[model samples]
Target: MILWSARWKSRIGASTIRGMTESSTQKDYLFKTIGVIGVGLLGGSIAAAARQRNLVETILGAGRNPSRMRAAQQSGLLDRGTTNIAETAAQSDLVIVCTPVNHIVQFIQTVAKNSRAGTIITDVGSTKQQICEQLKGTLPAEVTFVASHPLAGSEKSGYEFSDQNLFQDRPCVITPDESVPAEAVSRVRQFWEALGMHVLQTTPVKHDLILAETSHLPHVVASALAATLATENFRYTSTGFRDTTRIAGGDPTLWIEILLSNRDAIVTSLEKYTQSLQQFKEAILNNDEKQLRQLLEDGKKKHDTLNSAP
Candidate 1:
């Protein structure tokens, strides 16, 4: 509610994230033309990665801003750039919707309308339930969908901050219901794997719940922690504080949609986190050395796992 972090601005998907990881191999062109909608960090990085690995024949970018699209095209990240959503969809064999959670369902519908038969469409959205459920039975019979979320991003936005290696060694989740074809799912998987991602598969419901804790909940906690300081205390902050609150710098507009779409799961995560926090507080308040040490040890043990995470 408090729009405090946009000033410092500059982030998703992590989840029981079980998946198969294949090593980077000889890059073969995966698709004829790949269309990317909303060429922000993830989208731009996808475009960049495809180009760097020569994964596609052509990369087309779409956005509301014509100038920005044109700039991305000029940078060679996109072979074509336009404000025309239908054109991008029609020309693409694979369409990657990189828009925010709220816009994805509607926007992909527009894309599906204009796409040719057998066009494979995927997304890098934060939440999967709303999008996957809403589009479940709705996409044109000719178009195929495999909802996905790549668990890597920066607190930065835009094409300039995007790196071709952004998806490298990171988990890229794919959520496909039973109706989607195995061939279609493989097509989406091949695309991400070519970009150096370790592919993960899960139900949309599971993806939503898992990411709410690993991704959405952290953003919420980061924002809450960042908002505690007064402007006068800004100069007193240091690297540790900035690192802890780095995600708080993400675009609020994008995150609000994520928070709302995954409301129930995020609330559950918040409840769990708060319960843990209360224990820490009680331990400190009572100056209970044994309890404090145990709590700290538990947190350390859990956090250390991140060091070995793939």
Candidate 2:
């Protein structure tokens, strides 16, 4: 939701570079206040990390339930709490929409309407293309939207399970379109990096496709695997069975939004996966030991490469 300025092109070349390589410890107190729209795992953890790193003067929590906001404020996770989106955005220098993908667009529209000039807007949404598309030009000239997805979270949800260290050593992707100012993108990247994340940037389309393969597909597979098992077999399950399907335990409501949002990309990944499964099925039925061994080895090598990465 950014209106482009001619001057930002002068420094556009440096935006991605600074995002990837900047090591400035001078990032303290970059914002006077940051408002987190949801008080769930990612949102609460962001509040915790910003506090621990001394990155802001104040932290605010905005959500639906008044009782939860009171609890978060009482727990010291937020300096203030409010159910009013405008009230939070009006006071925040930076507003992060941490709601699920389905609600992010509407929340952002509210934020853009109420945010003061020069306020920076961002999100922890896992999917970005739709958000970017829906809110493309709907902003005040000074309010900026830099879509971000922190590639960090747990099957578990809620504030109590949120750890400040959750983003440590994790990857965060910021998707800023051509109309966004380079300076805005750099600021959002700095926000994530200050929290111990490795930052990257790309088109929202590419981000969705990549995450479809690495994250969404896996969750679907895990849930499907878990569903295939019988209730009577639960007592006989071992670590391998449990480990393979642990992501199935994630809240079904949240996962539903994620799955449908990126269903196109996820379907592509699933087609490739089903082909692999078919190959394995044929190999097993034909008793082709060599073919089965080669498929297993191929999977192992790919996994080994991932584990070997620094």
Candidate 3:
């Protein structure tokens, strides 16, 4: 399935024939060129990390925005950049779809036709179930498709904000269905680890449910809290209020897509959140000092535990 191969070697050094053969086979049969389908913060960071560590022989970026693609190329994040997804997929040994959640299925479909046989495909989406479902039917059987989500990001977007070390020691969750080859899954894990990330494996459904509470709920609550405070007492706000709501200022379009794509899990999370809020409200209304104090103390303890956690 591969077109060519390259063995890792220094100009002045030589390798055993067996070592060279294995390296060449790994480059050709395992991985070589890595394609990133959205060179914004997450994609750019991945590309930069791969290049920094020589994880792949080449990194190519593709996106609708030519300007961002050019920026990624000029910033040393990618070896090449283009607006054509097919070209990127066709040329890459590994393809990481890093576009917004809403665009992921469409992008995969767009590039699927041109993806080479045995090309390893992956994604960096917040939710994984819908993405896995779409890829299950549309992606070619020859292409090894695996879903992954790296648990690292900033409340920022755009290529300019990308950091090469964004995934360093971060938890990168991989969701592979039964149809995925064991070797392919291992290769995907090895690739993420090569980028200095710790790999965690989970089912797509589990990932969606856990993240709905641990990730999406926090973003929604932060935005809601900021909106309520700004409406009622913006004039009295200070650094503490600003810091707490900082993530609320994240890209609205991106968040909306993520929320809508994973609506079922998010709705479940919201129901639990609303029940907790109602309990607090009832405590205040009944003038139950003990209940109110317990609620506040519990919240403080939980926050402290999270802050102190590894």
Candidate 4:
């Protein structure tokens, strides 16, 4: 088992580690204080999960809305809530920027400015290439920024809908460039692992491309499908329709930002998706039962492979 060195032990503090005996099954309390910026669904869920798992001693929340933050604090989603991002960053061992994709880089810049040396910073933004590029050379050498996207959450929003198990058994992709310190990457990986996430490492560019196909494209398709349904069709909706369009009900503002941030990759995925749709239309137009069956079988096999994969 890996042990904390004297330097880390000193940094972690004796009080925080008090009564924490080293054991194989012991959960790692990786952060003494965790600062979560934007205490909305994803941010609130992270704070709640960390508290439930005892992964952090304290969770400081920073957001634009005071009333929302106050409600979150009262609901036990945060230990304290503030509008000052820098102040929260200053006190936190790790700062997680959970704001919208557009605001994440600015939040990280604020955090980097106020945070001391050796602080590890990360973001939960859906797109990474832009964020990683914007953050490059903006932070002090002593600070580390690791971009992460947790493949979790639901169509639900707000702190009220947040759950402690939001990220349980979920895949979290960590995008760490060569500029990031090796130790910082390990710490962030362990932190996510403590939250019960299966940490996957990849480059920021690759992550953006993959998420465009897997996440952004799906949301776009769902929204389009839902939009195509007439208002009168709601009464005739079945489980299949509702299931396919569930994500269409997500916050439009958030999805707009995500799509725009990764527009290039999303557009590429959309082109491919449209091509497939065109092929399907052609098969139907020609009354080609064999081609249609083959297409359906191929899709089913691909989905089955995904479902059966570890």
Q: Write the per-residue lDDT of candidate 2 for residues 58-111, one digit (tens) a residue.
A: 789999999988877766777786798899999999999999889999999999
> Whole-model Cα lDDT per candidate?
0.86, 0.87, 0.82, 0.86
Cα misplacement distance, residue 95 of candidate 1 (Å): 0.3
| lDDT preference between candidates 3 and 4, better one | 4
Q: Write the per-residue lDDT of candidate 1 for residues 33-111, one digit (tens) a residue.
A: 8999999989989987887675776789999999988877766667788999999999999999999889999999999
* Per-residue alpha-carbon lDDT of candidate 3 for residues 1-310, written as tens digits (9 for 90 to 100): 0110111122112323423665645654347788999888899788767765656667799988997677566555667889988899999988998999888888877667789888888889998988888777777787878889998888999766767689987899999999889999999999888878899999999999999999999899999988887466787889998888888988999999889988999999999999989999999999999999999999999999988877
Query: Residues 123-153, candidate 4, lDDT per residue (tens digit)?
Result: 9999999999988887888788988999987
Number of backbone clashes in candidate 3: 0
Model 1: colliding residue pairs = none
Q: Assess every candidate by TM-score.
A: 0.89, 0.90, 0.86, 0.90
Question: What lDDT is reached at residue 119 by model 2?
Answer: 95
